[model samples]
Target: MTTPNESPKDKPSSKQMICENESSTTKKNDEGDNVGGGVESVDGQNMSIDDANETGIDDPKGQGSSSRKRGSTIDVAIQIGSGSGSGSNARKKREMEIPRGEPTCYVCSKNFTSWKAVFGHLKSHQRETPGALPPPTFTPTEGSPENNNDDETNPREQLAPTLLNLALETMQKMSEDSNMSVVHRPSSAFNSPFWTTNSGAPVWNNNSSLTVGARAFFTKPGGANFDRERIPERVVHARGASAKGFFEVTHDISHLTCADFLRGPGVQTPLIGNFDLVGNNFPVFFIRDGMKFPDMVHALKPSPKSHIQENWRILDFFSHHPESLHMFTFLFDDIGILQDYRHMDGSGVHTYTLINKTGKEHYVKFHWKPTCGVKNLLEDEAITVGGANHSHATQDLSDSIAAGNYPEWKLFIQVMDPADEDRFDFDPLDVTKTWPEDILPLQPVGQMVLSKNIDNFFAENEQLAFCPSIIVPANAPKCVYHNNHHEGFMNFMHRDEEVNYFSSRFDPARHAEKYPIPTAICSGKRDKCIIEKENNFKQPGERYRSFAPDRQERFVKRWIEALSDPRVTYEIRSIWVSYWSQTDKSLGQKLSSCLSVRPSY
Candidate 1:
């Protein structure tokens, strides 16, 4: 009944309009009577006025009309087209209303105006899937229930068990039982301290070296005593910190490994752990193969002539090893510059064998996840911390232990069944590669807690040593048994020959036959000493792509900046490009773009 040119003042506002063409598309229905209007598509699909109105499409009180109200929001709308009729039917309209005021998030109770903001807030509220709670977000409000509850709970009650407690507990139980009075201790003669030559002897005056005459004929005589004061540093990991802890059995893994440590729950093995930054927080090393380890160290160490570190020279040396790309990506990431020892994660960095009682060997990698979670300092923070305290990490670790805030690490092992190793996307035994956590799930293996600070830093922390070669309990597999046996045999023979000629007059070995020497045999075992069967680049590629789009851009940019150094040669650049291309084509292409030239290789 309304004229086409007349605008309705009662209609909703323009902002609430769900459909703009609702007024222009009105029509009559099949009964030959005008019933509101009908919608007709160019393709000939049509909707009756009544159906459109019910759907809030052609109805005046529906989304299309309500959308123009003072306070309304509509995501969708529909319109009815005018059909030939006695008189053109008026278009119907409707609009949806958006609720006002802040909506409370169901998960965290945070207030948000939109669903998107609320959803994002909920993600932060979600705890880690492993059942560990993140640090509290806010301090308890004054006199609140949380504050009252905190007053009842003593902070000291939750401290991790200490070594002193363990020793005291053992002593107390032993003392309580009368039957445990007699105990045999190892012979004290073996532990006797005698100042002697490399061979056994009693040397009286070690402080003053043998000189010709005290005042007149003073002559520098022997260098033997001076040389004995120093010992060689380890070939790798020259800078490291060691602490005593225990590795406990968390899950039953006796089926996969014959190692004693994994035999059962409640079993604990005394362990000494050492951590080195490996030049960064992330575990990517310079080389994939153990064979390249010596060479890599040689290149990174100071120049033999100057005994000073030269970054340009080191970079030039590593530039030849194209396979080092995977590691370099990690080394250059934000995790590279860690603030202190407590914040970073530790890795075994090498694949080891885990054998079962049946002599079946499975490849495995070890990881130490910090309970505090993985955190790293930016480059600027690293510089500031380093400048203020060169030994900041060492001090932090020592102080934390002294204060009873023991550092904790959860041990996890990624196991690879021998039969399925070949089917994996990357080489399991490759030291330079990382197993994708999504594919090879991390199995819990108890935890290690450093509850006691060493009394003597030199004797315990400094002199302590760790070797990947050391394994105890039957379930642990020996990957290097053949090589170790050979080396041991040769070492024993060499030591025996020296002892036969060099024993002192008081030696018992001079009158007796030499100790029995061990023999080495090759069993021709297909699995022994063999590298793990898998590819290596797939995970590294996945890591690169897993970063947010913005992060990916930054990573690529950082790589280019490093590669663009004038010192990086053309040949090295080509090799690097080729290596990156193998990991990811887009990464390689972006890197090439930064260089302003296509890589020849």
Candidate 2:
């Protein structure tokens, strides 16, 4: 209870305080309001079990005064429910009594176990609220009567130190709850503004709330929205950095595609680039089929059991998918670890059909070559750079844009006729294989310039969204379209129409010119099997042979390091050696010699 040995009849009916054999005189503030609503206490029988159980509202504004109330009583009511010592087994269990003294609410005689909860509860009280002395934040100075003998001073003087301690505790808790760094800065001149209670109308009321305003968390319309402030992240490209810029068409591609942005030369499209494409980094992937993506991610990510990225798990997964060897050429190469965002090359990796105005289809692959040229740090340099700061690339890109030193990339595309698809030794549709640049040369299409650094980090990066139906916001789409299947979650469109559908008469919307969509006459059975021409070894072998002597040695060293994983058994190691042998006999020989495993080849 707030205080003991006070009038039981004075407490609010909600408390239901039960007192026995105690005459309590209800203490009052200087303004004459009863402390704890006239609650009383007894020596051993004024058990405040009700105080510990019944609690009032907790206010986030953090009410209660820093200074102690001029007139207050120090009556603590504590209890431990007990029963007869000897009885039946169930009765004996009930006989045990645990003390629940904890601090009581000075405002309403409610008891709480934790001092943090007590201080947090105190936030509900307003300064003007009756009997809200709040817990103190510190002891009175050494010379104050608080340091004197307990009998020499009244309980109010003794109560000052306890109240001060609680206030200190509550402030510290509020600091943590607000998620503010505790670092002290000499140059900082920041102070918290007064808390708003009723909507956005700044006020000091703890109990008041506007119908559609900022109120307490428990209130109907308060900070509930803040609780769900996080925008969802992309499942795959969750980690990303982006900048705003423009992609200008550098050459005419109107003959190849009817797309608006690529219609003519010198046309620019505002673009946002989020380059956290793990698979995109290498221009090739471990698996050819999109269906294997889930397993690929699982192998690359931490193991389900150990929660560590184990080489054995990755090798084992790739062992079953031999087509991954082509990708391994770049993965273990010297330039595998990117230097930074600005000096990197990118590719579409997948073949997509581009339809012309006449409905002629040509499978195309887009490539990005940095205007600054390809730059790669050696393994040691990369180690040092990453150890210093993992976000070094993001910082570099943002800083470059901010300093007016824009990073630029030239866009190029390779197109092939559908009739020539069967002429290739390797499956052109396989993402694990790259189109030969000599045969299908890259045609320069555009140049992308990242001139502007993002303004809002969350809005630009974390909250970035992608949908098949919607492009990046504010970027003018030369082709007009509508989201006919509209109005679901997060639908913020302002429309008075009751119908949202294609060709709806009730709410008519204009249709854009019909764009040519690709279609093909098919005669094959739908089945899950590797592509017929799975020539997984040729490209990887050619790539390995192209690397210089030391570069080949570095690639072999990386493979040895990966194969040294204790969990990578002899069978899995041999499986890898077989893939390496098929890729390049010399590469496989080096691995077998170093790993001492027989080659499956």
Candidate 3:
């Protein structure tokens, strides 16, 4: 042994370690069990492990802190320390096997070989008093009450601190020969396989009702799943039908759009699909700005207090938004209550940009005209049928496909030149206005047919996601590669790098391959601003005038019913009248005159 004054450099014999000979290998002690065993050094320091443990060693980091020196090869360092008496005693009793009648857990009564492991395993159990719980062991073995309920000292608590310090010191070394830290025997590794709880505790008697005796009532997850007995109804789109089919090109309109998916005229599924115009039966969205969507949803949904969708709330909120008048005109029409999903004409109300392969960009709008023609239900008819089955439209469409009768819709697009954007009287970018079909014309692109019903009703709602191909730079998963600085909702692409990828660490990259950007240049420090020309009056006026005399009366009647709600205020009523008057003079007067005489509901 080296003296306290002796330098490590002077002790060349202790510096270089050698692998042990056969005589120095593992052998059982007087106890007839493998006391000190042979284990491969994880860091390769001490090879003759048993001899080092029998005789004490000194440690530089005091006690329970000496770890093997990590290097190029695995070596077990001979922890040179005069360790504590309790720690040395715990080390002598370290084991890798649990013979019958071993130390059992106070809670679950699980047997353990290493005292350090039992000290660690108790942490997974609760300290408080527990119920008469099943042991959950695969074997129907009964737990002795003396082990749990007795006032006698726990085998774990009596030996816990020594085991705790042994566990702490055992981690200080890396030899499986002297430490049980390297050896692990998890319950799942040896126990019978079954579904586990959220925390991964196994349940043996999973046939919840069937028991060994009559005592197993609702053991863990082995009972009726009352919490999830019925799937809580979908909060949104609660009643809607979905179908599977393909979009086929009826006409080659490749000259108008840049997408290769829309370029081909066949049955191939286009995943990187470029364009989709999100729409409903109406050809206009109520709100102008996307930010107003959340507030609009809050107002239009069922009242937080009443839990019912009140028309007065819808009116009072939208009366402030004059742009919503065009949608109101559609909603008040006889065609407002759609009789069937198959017969409705869907329109993408928003103005979307379509660029040809040659880089010529054109403003466009989308339309889906059903081949089955249009259908509608009056107020009386809708109430009777809807009350019978709230999911009538969903069930009807599914039943139609199962009966071998399919529904089809023809896709059409109205294109306009960006240079000619000023030629239109109404704002082309305004979602509230629809392009005049007479002048712009519906260019037939393709047709979609629902040939089959969806296989599973509760599968993932991975429906066709149709939106503008751009997103905010802040929401980017990675750096945005493209940089034209075109017109997008959240178009801030504030970046320091001119070249995102190709760059040297020391020197900033200046070289870039210049590409032609669109002729429409964006120049402004971004700020909150409305569209320059919000001509909300013109479209609503034109649409109201186009409706038949009887249809116009129905529109007037619906507005009166909406305005007559007791919750509807006089200030909001006047605001809606002023809004409708700007839409059409004759129609506005009819609504104003009707509301003055109508009784409050």
Candidate 4:
């Protein structure tokens, strides 16, 4: 097989020659199928070597060509002979007996009618080759000892390259506990010794169908194994890592709330987390009203048409909602991009009410301060780190827990009296506003320690859910809270009572003793209007002033870049500059200078 310029000195060894021949043969076998040179046919259509390779990999007998050839023959025969009268009758019987199920492939999201088909498809994804090399189509070499070209008692030769590739793949998949001994079993559904149908009838020979003396074939398609592998990803915090831990009460807040989870000091509940403290790395949210939540998310998400997230889209969307300015101050600030989940702080974001045993109500806001001081990645740093490993934060958290560097967070609350709500210029319940630390200090409540990593992320983290409506009676506002009995999607709760309504005579569930709550009074015609106290500029101006000189310049530069987008209209640019000028004159002037656009205000 040498070229015209070949020398005897450059002639490859027997092993090298075997490898070259096998590699070329495998490539030709795969490519030839596309060019209509394949040997097998299924249902009047040519079957590629790639399909054969998939079957051969999943074949329990191994990837030998003899095993594959037998399987292919059986498949071809089954496909061609399936249109007979008896086969038609059998299919009709199957259709009547078995309901159709669309089992979806988890990897590719492809749907199949039978378990056999889906499982067979999954085998293709499971095949792993070395680096960029394709999966080996193992065909036995003629001169190899296993199938020697010339039969002999004694053999002296190197192993075939196909076998070598298989050996390397097997070695790569071996776990660290490979040496551990195990007792083998052939128990029910425990790695059945023989191939079987879904109904437990052992398949005598997988290569051929069960036949009555070659008169008719009675091959039964396996039942569909429908796998609901994933739950709907969270709308907001879709990408996050959660760790298990207990929230221990450190302070006596019995006067604050009569929640069983918050009963008294030293009292604890196993899984009743400290008020489902659902929060984000950033304290403030993008929108204030619940009505705008969906729209805000739509804008923040990838474009509907292109499916790509662009800053221009986000900036344009938020440009309409000036109240989002304060939030963007933090979003575009020095700590805009967090390094990891563990290093960032969290907030409840919304104001809640707390009732004392005496029925006195107080407005409360919750916060979680990380024990590890807050850390963040700069814009350049975030791009580089995120580009390197998209799952860097998740990996960091898991690695830290495995290495025993457990992360901890301290719980704190800021309480305000009902009358004092008017004392502040901003609305206490407005989610867009942050209760200043200088005015209303954070009260120490308890601490949380995530010492253990979850065993199964899907079972624990993915299925886990929480809702603000799940609040205790004491934390719930009297006039605002009401039962609508609206069941949500993916509600995992189990209830088995005929009476689903509250206050039913048959139901034993009774309302807790009344506690004092705010007497919220509303007297207005239903109309769409903006909040009267939308003093959106002051806090943002304060935030801008609080930043260091260099940081402020960076912030201005970022705004300038966003405003300079050719897609951004002159009106939008003027509006943003005017808004910034309202916040800080110097900032507006700086941006105006960079973009060569005059501030409207």
Top model number, lDDT: 2
The local distance difference test score of each candidate is 0.52, 0.62, 0.58, 0.59
For TM-score, the strongest prediction is 2
Clashes of each: 38, 15, 14, 1
Cα lDDT tens digits, model 4, 269-317, are 4443435666777778777655455556777888878998777788788
Give per-model TM-scores. Answer: 0.50, 0.60, 0.54, 0.57
Ranking by lDDT: 2, 4, 3, 1
Assess the local accuracy of residue 292 in candidate 1 as a C-alpha lDDT between 0 and 100: 41
Between candidates 2 and 4, name the one with more favorable TM-score.
2
Residue 417, model 4: lDDT of: 86
For model 2, the superposed segments whose C-alpha errors exceed 4 Å read 1-234, 273-279, 474-481, 490-496
Q: What TM-score does prediction 4 earn?
A: 0.57
lDDT of 1 by residue, 1-601 (tens): 1236545564332112111222333443321111232221211112222222322222222334322212212221233223222232444343322112232343345555433344334334432232222332333334333344433222211111121122123333333433333432223323348565545566664433233332112222233343232356655555666555677777788887665567888888665422221224455566654434445677777876788766556667676665566776676666666666777787877666667776667777778888888777766787888889888888898899888888888878888775676676555555667777788899987788887666666666555433344432222332322221324411322222222333455443434434323232333322213233434456568778877887787677777777777777776677667677778888889877777656656
Poorest stretch of ten by lDDT in candidate 2: 91-100
Error of 3 at 519 (Å): 7.0
lDDT of 4 at 351: 84
